[model samples]
Target: MTASPNRGLALTVGAILAIWGILGFFFAGEGGHAFFGNEGGYLWGVFLVNPALCLVWTLLAAAMLIGGLGTTIGSRNLNLLAGVVLLVLALYGLLFMNTSANVFALNAVDNGFNAIVGFVLLLTALAADRENLRALRADRDDLDALRAEAAHG
Candidate 1:
């Protein structure tokens, strides 16, 4: 029942994204914008988003929330996974920011934000839970030694 920093981060990010995702629908398609169009309105006058992006955000948020509410290991793993995915998505979005391939309606701001969040998640997952990591490593080492002794015997 150890509390993970990743859990806190996941919960906070998940909640914020959930709220943004819901509000995003209201401003998604402004003036006949396509569902996956490059053109989109800003969420809270900051992050550019469309229906597709909102859906993606909502899905990610759900995952984060669920992970946060689960075991510490679950949160850490989820953060790692989500961070990698977000980083890749951010790179893709940045590359196709102004193209028709930008189905998520991602802009520079969104890409930047995604990159930042991704990095944060990744770093936290790798750096946090030191005690658990040490214990796990120690357990593995002990297991290895036991196995070696059993094989020799």
Candidate 2:
């Protein structure tokens, strides 16, 4: 049988989250040694940039995206939070990173792409909740109509 629209929507969001998370794991591991230029808490690679922060943001985004799974039950907050974290991570890469002679240009590319996707995830999460909200409104309207009828009777 065909899946309901809401379930389809949730599955799509979940898939995106999972894919992004997997990509992030690879990005974080390689980033510390390739970009930041260092090996520990600090970066020793390109322009002494810190890839550690990227790891943190990526994890946070992962968490947020995972939270989107619960959006069906009015848990869009996680998705929203993920969007914010991704945006913030993008900004960090944009503002602090020295793109002049970066090793992996793909890192920069992923950062930019993730920024756009973060917002999209948030939008999709909201859209998925729309049907549930409509149902609630309908229920409220029916209750009001019943009350009115009772008053007349």
Candidate 3:
């Protein structure tokens, strides 16, 4: 029942992504070029800070945050899946930087950032799962030891 260390990592990452996505819209401006570059196009400088990309990031953030809150196997599985999907999307963006084939305003900088973020999420999820398993095994061992002591005494 203890929370995984990676749960904090997930929450942090999710909050950051969610905040960035939300702030992106405000800074986008009417011309869609307030913070770094313009929007409404497939590519913009080295960032794909479009509304669609923002929305996607926000949703992903939400999923990660929510998944991190639960201590169930299902929640962990969902987190793993989300991490994989994020990594795939980042890889796709990197592979097709010049094209808008995936409907994402991808660029080397943004995609590279995405890749790092995704990698972190994936690594954290794996670590969390491993920790959870270790905890379970320890619990079982403790129970076994207790039962043995009870039987002997």
Candidate 4:
């Protein structure tokens, strides 16, 4: 299949997230914070991170990479799923950032990043895959028509 926007975004974002997650581990608990607490140190003095958050990002990166390496529909669907999940996480982080409930050690920057990336993923998946879907359906219909014609002939 042709390279779609969703596929490209998924691969690119997944790679970046994977790298960040991996590197974040080296700095996790730098100040002796809890594994899941919000008091973890900053990554590159920007993004707040912890072991749990790194694990989450690694898992998310896996999903994104799997989707990106699969079919177009798979990429789009995974992007949508990831988008929704990230948006929810963003909201949760915003609400519990400074509380004990901040299990992912999220901060304002993380929440904002999640929200923006989530929105972009959602928008790209929803609005950019129409042509691909239509083309796929057309191909399937053509294949079916050809099979029927062969059987009848």
Best TM-score goes to which candidate?
4
Q: What TM-score fits each model?
A: 0.84, 0.50, 0.69, 0.90
Question: Between prediction 2 and prediction 4, which has the larger TM-score?
Answer: 4
* Best by the lDDT measure: 4
Pick the winner on lDDT between candidates 1 and 4: 4
Q: Tens digits of per-residue lDDT for model 3 on 104-152? A: 5556776777788778767766766686767877998999999999999
Instruction: Compose the digit string of candidate 4's lDDT tens values, residues 25-134.
Output: 88886978788787787898989999988887888899999899888889999999989988998999999998989988999998998899889999999999798889
Candidate 1 minimal-lDDT segment of 10 residues: 1-10
Clashing pairs in 2: 36-44, 36-45, 37-44, 37-45, 38-43, 38-44, 38-45
List RMSD in Å for every model shown: 3.2, 7.1, 6.1, 2.0
lDDT of 2 by residue, 1-153 (tens): 112333344345556545544444454465345443323222223212234444554465455444444434434555555556667666765664455433323245546755886676567556666767677679889999999999999
For model 4 the TM-score comes to 0.90
C-alpha lDDT of residue 38 in model 2: 27
lDDT of the structure predicted as candidate 2: 0.51
Candidate 3, residue 109: how far the Cα is off, in Å: 1.7
After superposition, candidate 2 runs with Cα above 4 Å error: 1-73, 99-106, 126-128, 134-153
lDDT of 3 at 151: 100
Q: Which stretches of candidate 1 lie over 4 Å from their true place?
A: 136-153
